[model samples]
Target: MARFFSRDRHGRRPLPSDGFDRALGIAHRWFLDRVGEVATIQYVTAPADMDWWRKDNTPPLISGGIGSSGQVALTLHRKFIELKYSDDGMLPERLYELLITEWAALTGKDVSEIDPEF
Candidate 1:
C-alpha cells in the first residue's frame, strides 16, 4: 500500500480523493469500530501550523476529545489511526435550531414548544 500525506501536514487529514462523503464514511467506520453506534464526534480545537518539525517531536492531533467518564471521541489525525477523548456538550446554535425545527416538523409539535435535549 502507498502512503498518503495529508494536505495539511500538521493538521487534519487530507480530503480523500472521493471527497467529504468518503471521508465521513472513513470516520464513521472508525467510530463504529471503537464505541458502537450513537457515539458523537467533535472537532475539539483547531490545529496549529508550521512547527511540525519542531523540538517536541509530536505529531499534531487532528482533533482530541472524551474518556472513561462516559464520553468518547473518534479522531482522524495528521497520521491516520490516532485516537483521543472528548466531552458531550450543548449543540451549536445553528445545529440546535435546525434540530429543533426538524424535531417540530417530524413529531407534530409546535416549534416554540419543542425543547431539544442534546
Candidate 2:
C-alpha cells in the first residue's frame, strides 16, 4: 500500500513531504487497528465496474426490509470502511453503539437521540 501511493506512473519513488508521510502513517495505523475485524479488504481500480454478485448469483430475497440472507452491510465511504455481518438485527444496533460513543466523545453531552446530518 505504501508503494502504491509512493511511486509515480513511471515507477519512480519520489520523496514524500512531511505532511503526506504523516497522513500515510495515520492511515496505516487506523487500518491496522481495524484489520482484525475485517473479513476481507480489496483495493479496486474501478469500484463502479466491480462485481457484487453472491456466490450463487441469486439476488437475496428481502422480506420486511431484511434480506433472506440475514446479512447487514455498513459502508463508510469517507473512511473507506465496509463491514458486513450475517445476523438478525445486530448490525444496526452495533452501528448505533459506535455512533453514540463517538458522539459522546466529540461532544461532552449524552445524547438520547441523534439526527443524522448525512
Best by the lDDT measure: 1
lDDT of 1 by residue, 7-112 (tens): 6646777653423233445545543443243434433233445465356765444333345664544343422222222211211233334333443454466765
Query: What tens-digit string does per-residue lDDT give for candidate 2 at 41-77?
Result: 2222223422553456543221111135532222222
Q: In angstroms, how far off is 10's CA in candidate 2?
A: 49
Residue ranges of candidate 2 with Cα displaced over 4 Å:
1-88, 110-118
| TM-score result, candidate 2 | 0.23
TM-score of each: 0.30, 0.23
Any residue pairs clashing in model 1, and if so which? 65-85, 65-86, 66-85, 66-86
Task: Give all candidates' CA lDDT scores.
Answer: 0.40, 0.34
RMSD (Cα, Å) of candidate 1?
16.0
Candidate 1: residue 54 Cα off by (Å): 4.1
